[model samples]
Target: MTETTRTEASKLMTEVEGISGAVLPEPAPAEAVTPLEQASPQEAEGIRQRMAELDMTDTTSIVQFGARAQSDLQSISQEMLSGVKNKDVGPAGDSLRQIVTTIRGFSVSELDVRRNRSWWEKLLGRAAPFANFVARFEEVQGQIDKVTDTLLSHEHKLLKDIKSLDLLYDKTLNFYNELGLYIAAGEEKLREIDATQIPAMEQAVADAPEADKVLHAQALRDLRAARDDLERRVHDLKLTRQVTMQSLPSIRLVQENDKSLVTKINSTLVNTVPLWETQLAQAVTIQRSREAAGAVREANDLTNELLKANAKNLREANAEIRTEMERGVFDIEAVKSANADLIATIEDSLRIADEGKRKRADAEKDLVELEGKLRHTLAAANSSKQAGGAV
Candidate 1:
């Protein structure tokens, strides 16, 4: 890790320790004394032999392990970042909006009975608004069902994301634990080089002759380089561990958001939908009752109108019958009018008979005159014919 990262990690660790009320052991000093100082001659000689046997190759496995751990940590970090980025609640918000719109679309006014319609319109069922109301209700219910399905799907996705986050959290913790072990191992190896191996190599270089000093010094340089490499590896592991630590909370935060969305979806399904449906059903019932009452009122009004008209017609007819019953069998005025009509008919018949007789007499006289004229015309024709013959 860089110096700044190290400093930050240390501060974070200190804060954690303070909150937990647990004091961590202090790190070993750079110049701490080694066991070699207290050892006997044989032990010291054995340690010197072991230090001489140590080569740069001994750290190869540790370096490879660190590299592998770093790669794994990188992969874990990337997976976590990608998961967090890809998770979204926009679909849930859309479902909520759909729900609100569906709820707002409900209007009881649509169910109101049309009172101004004519009797024929009611008889034909045109004035019955319940059919349209029921259709609208069904349509709104279908919309609600669609919203519910969408919410449920979104909730399932959130649940799946939360499960993935749990797995990611576990992986991060594992990486953190692994990094702790790697850092501990690297620190121990570094302390060994600082306290024992390098010191032994330095002593050997000081005691050797000039020609051999160069070889011992080169070995010392190699040991120091290995120590530096181990330190760098430890720092790299610490940085990776810090990344895992940060990832822990990030995964949890994303999971929390998913959980919150799931809770809201559950509330919408379990509470809001049921309550709305119940209220809608009640409204429909009330509207039906109102329509029934209106029908009854219209029937009563029509009955009253028919009764009043019948009563008025009956009164007029009864009055006319009472007047006819009160009068004589033959009314004087009716008899007088009938007698006058009979007399006028007789006079018209007599006048018509006299006129026909006179016309017939005149016709007879005209016939006699016509016959004389025909005879005279016949004689004239005969004389003219005879004269022509004699000539």
Candidate 2:
């Protein structure tokens, strides 16, 4: 039978048991059981050929491998279940591996399918419950494998994110710190202008010869406007600080979470999975007697329960990763966009202030020319008045 067919049959058997409240049939005879012997040369060669045909990187290979194992088991099960009711032990024994000496003493009649259960057999029960646990645990194990592979695939990218974000935050933080110093220095300059320069200019406007009053007033206006532009730049710097403060926390939070996740993954790989493997070894130990089988079943059941509980950590880790990814904390575009806008505004403000200074210089030159022309006209008028008086 195919692996899929076997799996379906297993499920159907379970459903039947549920309806009829009848226990599953006894496990196939030792001859029917496929022991964990080293693969024969032919079987190993076949496995190698099949694996060589597959892409190792493709996750579907995992399923294919499980199916291959199941198919082998199904073939063995068919051989044991076929015509066993009427056949003698001799024929059945002939079909088994040479290691069939273990049960050679038992007669065909003694090995009947409907034999009465011994006291120990009744007490130990079958391995169905343990099998169920193993089946469910296998599913969980597959999930962990996929999750671990995914986490590893993105490991480098996540590290890159942490580095980029850290560098960006540090650079911006330094800039803001320097800006704080600049704002302080600018405030001091403004205070000096208020204390000394502005008052002196105001007095100059007040005490200026009447002809120069308009020129003095214009100079003072230009100085005050330049100071106001400095204040505006300081205000914009404060806003930039606010933006950096607000955005930085989220980036830091992501970085911390990522670090924590790395630690958890390492722990799971180094400690958790290895421990599970050790427990699995104990659970799958080969045994023949009813008591030994019972012990193995209990061990497998406990291991499965422990694994089911531990699987939650993997689920939680994946969920946390998705949350941070959805938040886009590692994406620098938004932060870069905001910084670019602020830089452009600062550049524009500086440009406008420079234009204002050029206008002020031109106004000063025009005032100087007007004053020279006024002096020349007054000299010419005074000479005309003296000449007229002499006449």
Candidate 3:
């Protein structure tokens, strides 16, 4: 039985003991788990919630509220700018100036992944057997790299588009708000001219001596023209406010769409990209594993063949030795001399064979090294050709 099965059985026994009013010993503390393993589910849930909020799904009610507020602001700016100079209006004008600066300086934050080592890079290493497999891995890896580059480029473009939208919305809101304050300030100046300056100019025109009368009349005319300009400004401000207010709903709609897109992109980065990497790694591992198995079979076959060849060589050597012994049996003295010579020859043959084995091993090593280099060069050339073709 598995450890888990046994643990469950023991737990069941403990539970039964507890239920039967028998005292059960307390269990030891569990092993500590890594933070990521413990909190991954919680983190995913948090991402989902945050992404949903950013998506602003079914947020029509809030959008309608914003639309209503924009409408109310339009009416308020129009009504408030009729004719009034107040101390409070001064602060509003200053605030409008600050808002203008703020909107002009606005910037958006961008998200990016840090470039790190890939899993395949650590696996391929400098092994002769794996060289071919590494080449294949690199080929697939090149495609993966292209995909990564494309995805990042797309993400950058998407962020740029969102930034543009944000800039437009901010500019629109600030322009209308500042325009309203400017209209209010203009109306206040117009009130001062009408209520105070105009009457004073008229009185001066009536009571001035003959020589000064012309000058007073000129002053009154200038005041009247200034008042007319202020009245026109009030009309223009009203029209601008109405037009801008109409655009508010549309801008908000676009913002909602952009926000949804950004949220999805973020969600994909968190969930989809990692899954892709995991599956891709698994695929590469399986490929390498299969290649390793094939290599093992090839090596076994080669070893068997080498053993059979070695056996044949041993049989030939033994037959030659038996022939030499049979010839030495013809004369006693000749046989002694022949045996001595044969011993020397056998020793010499053993030394030659040992030298030949060492030389063969060296040649094999060199050949293997050359083959590895050739394979890598060909792989690189093929990759380059493929890239050129793509271009």
lDDT of 2 by residue, 221-271 (tens): 877876666566546645655664565566567566545444444444445
Q: Write the per-residue lDDT of candidate 1 for residues 192-271, one digit (tens) a residue.
A: 77999889999999999999999999999978888887778678767767766776777777666676667677666666
Question: What C-alpha lDDT does candidate 3 achieve relative to the native structure?
Answer: 0.52
Please list the residue runs of candidate 3 whose C-alpha ends up more than 4 Å from where it truly belongs after superposition: 1-212, 228-232, 235-250, 325-328, 331-391
Clashing pairs in 3: none
Lowest summed lDDT over 10 consecutive residues: which window, candidate 2? 27-36
Model 3 is weakest, by summed lDDT over 10 consecutive residues, at: 106-115
Show the lowest summed lDDT stretch of 10 residues, model 1. 24-33
Most accurate candidate by lDDT? 1
Give the Cα lDDT of each candidate.
0.69, 0.52, 0.52
Q: How close is candidate 3 to the true structure, as a TM-score?
A: 0.34
